[model samples]
Target: MMDPQIERKLIEIMRVIHESDKPIGARAIADELNNRGYDIGERAVRYHLRILDERGFTSKHGYAGRTLTELGEREMNEALIADRFGFVISRIEEMAFRTSYNPETNEGVVPVNISYFDKDDLETVIEIVSYTAHEGYMISPRVRIIEEDEELFSLPPGKIGIATVCSVAFDGLLLKAGIPVEPAYGGILQIENRKPARFSDLISYSGTSIDPIQIFMSRRTTSVLDVLEKGEGKILANIRQINLSAYERAREIMEKVEKVGLAGYFPPGEVGETLLGAPIETGKFGIAIVGGINGICALEETGIKIKTNPVSTVMEYKTMTEI
Candidate 1:
């Protein structure tokens, strides 16, 4: 059995490798570790990497360094699940602060979710995304299709990737405009007669280890296509709390953002009033927007397999095209 301290170091190394888009050398990994406040040097990183390679958690590439194997990813994700609690909320806040997209100029970056599917399913995937976006159920109509050669990160063999703007981009815009926003929950917002009715289920962002949207998708909990066709079904959504003081500014920012092509259909509710059956606290209102993965949810409902990375990365707004 590995020593507890060794296991911790290995997990940290795997995390760094998992985050990289390409093979990372020991020197680079060591430098990254040091930046993260670890005292490990390149030689030590290389020594530990050998253990990872022997355990099949990583594969070494000549002169390039090492790439995390599938085992590594699974191990890392499952290793310290406790440490990942509330990670989603932290990710949202970080991405919101990192967002620099300027609707006026159509420049800067916005947070996005990435999904992968078999190359053969590309056309079907595009069709589903297009139909969902056209019906106005997605966070935005903007999307970026990544071919093998254009992939920003490694994808499984025979898989293609797509990037959709995350709903958090709205928070980013609001934050950029000096409006502080609080993400409350990710939930299943039930729709009735083509309007959002209430939340059927909710997972607090501060308590869950996995992305709630992913959880819902894995459980096949959404009826996104039904909502599009019959105007009544549960779909993925999230609630954010914003102070009433900045509500008007937030609204104006939303308008400018939508004008530039990202669709956010829901408006903030009155302070202390319920929005979609979720009660608002004093001095703050709730804003519930459809999850960006609604399109993918529709596809999943049809039994098409997809691998998703929610709030995966930020991409330039100008780089994505309208669906």
Candidate 2:
């Protein structure tokens, strides 16, 4: 592994070069570092820049300065990942302390609650919580195993439960629960309203039009899902319209919801290809759930219901179950 201080300086130097429009010299880099309160000297910066060049992270121009190579951009991305991991660790420590009592004083008490889950379940919770925090959501999750309880003799031996003290927003919870569902049903809402183009103009508009799943894509980030389009022109038009309409409609919807102060509900299958302006034959434009079973449960808890038929015919199962 590289020395931590050297790695940090290399990352900082790459950041300076990346942010600049043109190649920069060591002196300029040192100045930028100083501005950021790093107190780095020009000589030190030059030495690190040389190391970076040798490592293929940066390349020197004849007299112009040094510029970051593709490798350098990747290194900067790694640095960001490192920073996010550090933040997650710090948050986990804070949550642990907040949930647990002081061993010596027996003070620093929290609400009395109990949870039961197995080791696998705990791992799932941790994975979800870490992902949630990494995505810029605030989550203070507390989890503990229930080792022993005579009052719960009928329960499993190793039961664990988790609770979270978080901001009031269904977005984070939905994302977490949807993590396990396959072909997640979640998609962006495309709204079109000519009257209100911006949030400020929404006050003059009485109603809004929403088109769900105008651009349907899978929730998996591992690989890009192929875009199923009927004809080239149809797909292009759909993309262009949704891209423009979604933003305008979003502003109007938010404004209307705020003014009316009422929740809106839409049943499953209510939104179809006709509403989204896409042909059903394309097989690209239908509402489908992602994240597997856990995702379906999460959606149900949020007051949206779904129906599914088994893809396999070998086994008999319930045709429909309300989430």
lDDT of each: 0.85, 0.35
Candidate 1: pairs in clash: none
Q: TM-scores across all candidates? A: 0.83, 0.28
lDDT of 1 by residue, 95-115 (tens): 898799988778899889989
TM-score of 1: 0.83
Per-residue lDDT over 230-292 for candidate 2, one digit per residue giving the tens place of the 0 to 100 score: 111100011111122133343343234223211121211222243232223222222211111
Query: Which whole-number lDDT from 0 to 100 does residue 35 have in model 1?
Result: 44
Best by lDDT: 1
Residue 145 lDDT, candidate 2, scale 0-100: 27
